[model samples]
Target: MSTLTTANPAYKLELTSSPHIHSRWSTKQAMWMVVYALIPAVIAAIVFFGFYQLIIISMSVCVCVLTESAIKYFRGREISIMDGSGIITGLLLGLILPPNFSLFGTALGSVVAIALGKEIFGGLGFNIFNPALVGRAFLQATYPVPMTTWSEPSYAVDSVSSATPLSAMKFDAVFAGKTEMLLGNIGGSLGETSSLAILIGGIFLIAIQVVNWRIPVAMTLSVIVFGGIFWLIDPAVYPDPIFHILSGGFLMGALFMATDWVTSPLNSKGMWIYGTAISLVIVIIRLFGGLPEGVMYAILFMNGFVPLINKYSVPRIFGEAK
Candidate 1:
């Protein structure tokens, strides 16, 4: 009998369907890819919000990793932060936050995200709500004033931060101009300031095939459809669809947060429904609700219903009756 050695001529390499799925594009890869996609936004934050943004992001990530590690350690379970889910959650929570937010608040948000959003429902892929959005919502509810407070950067004389365009529009409709909203020159959350930067990151994600384009597309369309209706009713009061799409957290939330594979729906039809529903909730809240911005809450809220959407929207197999 011939031995199966490298030198033996009988050696055969068995090829399988999933053979190439070794370690190149795994869960770890996905986590790292998300981080990679956010680098541009991080750079944008640093430019627009200053270096303290980096500090906030770092501290938030550190807290999340430590919080999760400690939970596993005290419970006599294995270290789980290595999976990088904590890292992704940290970045997402950090990026959505305002630049000057206190370190303690960021840490609290991280804890809420990892503990309530992730660990309670089982870590990583098993979670129902998007962890980062959970943190965002918690912070928004607990610290309504500070969370909404925004400061514009000064290229001119010394100036203080001001409310963002969307926030302003939420209160009064007269401030929605063409240039201010388009260029993202207003003050807002660290990541939501720059629609240009967010769109760049979105393009990279779509290029890598890491995110499903369907969700963003559907979400954008839904926003336009809903916003357009209001604009038609009162063009003077309601901002145009372009301003609606660019201002606030719509692009940032739809492209980066809402498209999270683990939390969002799985099927193509489900993605459209998920995106559309979220967009509707966001528009409704921003238009009539108390909160100036509602993208984060809308996403987390709809994330709760994703399983049901996936359960029903799944296309039946061919020749198989439902």
Candidate 2:
């Protein structure tokens, strides 16, 4: 009888780690997309403020890119300024600044944003706070007068007060109409005046899946629910919920800064908690605190708790023991 020969397998199994599926977008793509999303705000800033605002924006971006490049060179790491993180930080800082802020101060803020806010903590992905906010906070402490000064937009009419909406409400008890704020006719930071422009960019980001929708939704809801309560208690004393949503930097901060992938929470549950806490703090500070605006402080404060939020909020692996 003829013996049958044993057959060898056609393919061999190879073991691999998790993350079997990969995203099509790279770090550079994500960073640049953020820059793209902010472009509408940048253009709106220039349109509302003036061409001088472009100079400020340019100065901030150049300084941020240069600072990051210098640090990378000194550390013997390959310079990756083109990766777009520096551009984003600078762009954001520029957007939030006073229209005609001194170039020197703008440069200093950009330096601080990249150095202390970013590279000191090991660069882009590792920074604890939003880099732009860090720089803004520094400038706020160092140059209080310049940072607080507001200017009338180029197209502003005599009826449109130069005082920022929040400032007007807080100090003068003057309510800037909802129509003016929505159309960006109110005096405010370069990029924060227009709810319309911010909404366009924010919605684009959310639609592209670049941003988590939960944080913004949670933050907006928190503001409406809490702000509404105060308004109902005394409409004369407290501004309405829509005013809270459209005025100041609430939309910009909720959509752009607080949703930062690095500083924000990871899981869905954690995002809701983080967003709610931020909005609550914002409400407290805006209504009762000495400051007219509290978005920067609110976002930075919540950034500190992201690690803890992630730790407890991670979902259990499927089919694993409790």
Candidate 3:
């Protein structure tokens, strides 16, 4: 009989490894904090794109959670839908997607992100790739027609024939120096356009200690420094380094994707090199390579080399064997 008693209850519950796991910090709480951190971006999306932003975000999250749950059930594993990882992945994916994307495609993206991006790599912390980017890349590769056709923040379906600013830069040289590119009035994926929103959220995460400050600082500095020299030499070709720093998806990738704790280098020196290399790759891709927005690919490319970075770039410990 389970009865309430002041002195002694009818039974004493046994506890295990996770008994005291949640001490003021929970995965759910942490995820919600991430959601809270995303509030500014959500507001920006809604203010620009209207209430449809909410619909897209909701669909992204719902599909991700449902897919995750279905996987757990089919695999005969404990339910983990409440942990909020699926929610995070969905939100990140939605933010990166073109706002005018098909709902079916969005759902498929969530499923792919979970099943291939995460679970197949042994789930969450063990994944070799960023699940969100994996889904984005998959869609980009498979459906270049819809995936590349970006639209400005518009409520009309007929007006969805815009190209992303990065694509524009890659294709149209005449439209390179426009303010719309930096201020996010241009066509692109929802979150990638607004460097302001990404910066605000990144700062919040850093202030709250939810994210480290190293990666963003190093990467941004590298891009600006490298791009600055070139821009100073020829403004006709290179936009302001500030524009390069603030435009497209650099902040979003540096702050969110490159800073993934599991995939990024653990030590300080390795972190600096990791972030710098990513930034250099981003610049190379944007300037010398084919891609206009290189953040996602740069992070994915470097994530493949994290283990090697960890091994070689690790600073010698105090009084350690040489």
lDDT of each: 0.80, 0.89, 0.74
| Residues 71-124 of candidate 1: C-alpha lDDT, one tens digit per residue | 777867677666677898898899899868989899999999988988787566
Question: Residues 1-322, candidate 3, lDDT per residue (tens digit)?
Answer: 0111122334476333311322244445665667777777777666656677678878988998888888878877666776677888888888888776888888888889889988787665678888888888888887777887666666434432266655655666434444555545556777777667777888988887766688888898898888887778877766667767766778788888888655787777888888889988888788778767888899999999998988898577699999
The stretch of ten residues in a row with the least summed lDDT in candidate 1 is: 1-10
Please say which candidate is ahead in TM-score: 1 or 3.
1
Q: What is the lDDT of residue 283 in candidate 2?
A: 93
> How far does residue 201 in candidate 2 sit from its true spot (Å)?
1.0
Give one digit per residue, the lDDT tens place, for model 2 in 22-87.
434566776788899998898889888899999999999999999999999999877888778899
Which residue pairs collide, candidate 3? none
**Alpha-carbon error at 235 in model 3, in Å?**
1.7
lDDT of 1 at 80: 63
Q: Clashing residue pairs, candidate 1?
A: 151-161, 152-161
For every model shown, what is its TM-score relative to the native structure? 0.88, 0.92, 0.85
Candidate 1: TM-score?
0.88
The model with the greater TM-score, 1 or 2, is 2
Candidate 2: deviation at residue 80, Å? 0.6
Best by TM-score: 2
